[model samples]
Target: MSILFGLLAVIIVLAIAYAMSNDRKNVNFIGIGVMLLAQVLTTWFMFMTPIGEAVINFISDIFNKLIEFGTEGVNFVLGGVTVEENASVFFFNVLLIIIFFSTILSVLTYLKVLPFIIKYLGWGNF
Candidate 1:
């Protein structure tokens, strides 16, 4: 069944991690367990809860707005080249959103918001 395959995949990944780890004696099982629990709970909530759906919808709306903003900038600079009847131009224009997201992420990193979460969550040690 699908569950068996999923379990196998997790085992394989953990085995690979164990093989690649430099300090094999210091494997933090508790941290791994906590992270796995968080992932499972988050997945369950995201798929099975109304509140999670609302949160996802809110984030999706924000992303759509950001993408629209990017498209506007692309249209301004490219002078409607992206709006032309060509798939290539449309694809190129879509990729412009990556630049927008990367800039936002870089700003968050500079402000130490991302690093703070990583440090406090023990993700840095992981």
Candidate 2:
């Protein structure tokens, strides 16, 4: 995931450079608009239903893994700290829950989730 995000960053930078070089003023606006929309939708979904739980769990899992790794290093230096009965797993579960939802949101958006959202949400009213 980190590698993918790094690649995305690189691609975005190159795209920005190309857009600027081409002098397409509207391109920047469009790019920003898309980003804003994606972020808003992501945030909205973050608060809803089982999807929210899934996303939280996913992120929590990532964090727990990192924390566990650090704890291992700490233990190696200080003769080990005992875990509190599956606490790590619980954290991971939460993280995975969140991440899963977020992943779904990303996939949906990539597949033009907005049209569905708009139609269902009656965004036309706005």
Q: Output the number of the lDDT-best candidate.
A: 1
**Model 1 per-residue lDDT at 25:** 97
The lDDT of model 2 is 0.67
- Per-residue alpha-carbon lDDT of model 2 for 1-126, expressed as tens digits? 996997699679868777677566545656665765776688678877688879988999987886666555555754754556747764343554565556656888889886688678765331
Cα misplacement distance, residue 80 of candidate 1 (Å): 1.5
Cα TM-score per model: 0.77, 0.39
Q: Model 2, residue 18: what's the lDDT?
A: 73
RMSD each, Å = 3.1, 13.5
Model 1 poorest 10 in a row by lDDT: 82-91
Q: What is the lDDT, from 0 to 100, of the residue 60 in candidate 2?
A: 93
Tell me how far the alpha carbon of residue 75 in candidate 2 is from the true structure, in angstroms, after superposition.
2.5
Which pairs clash inside model 1?
A: none
Candidate 1 CA-lDDT value: 0.83
Clashes of each: 0, 22
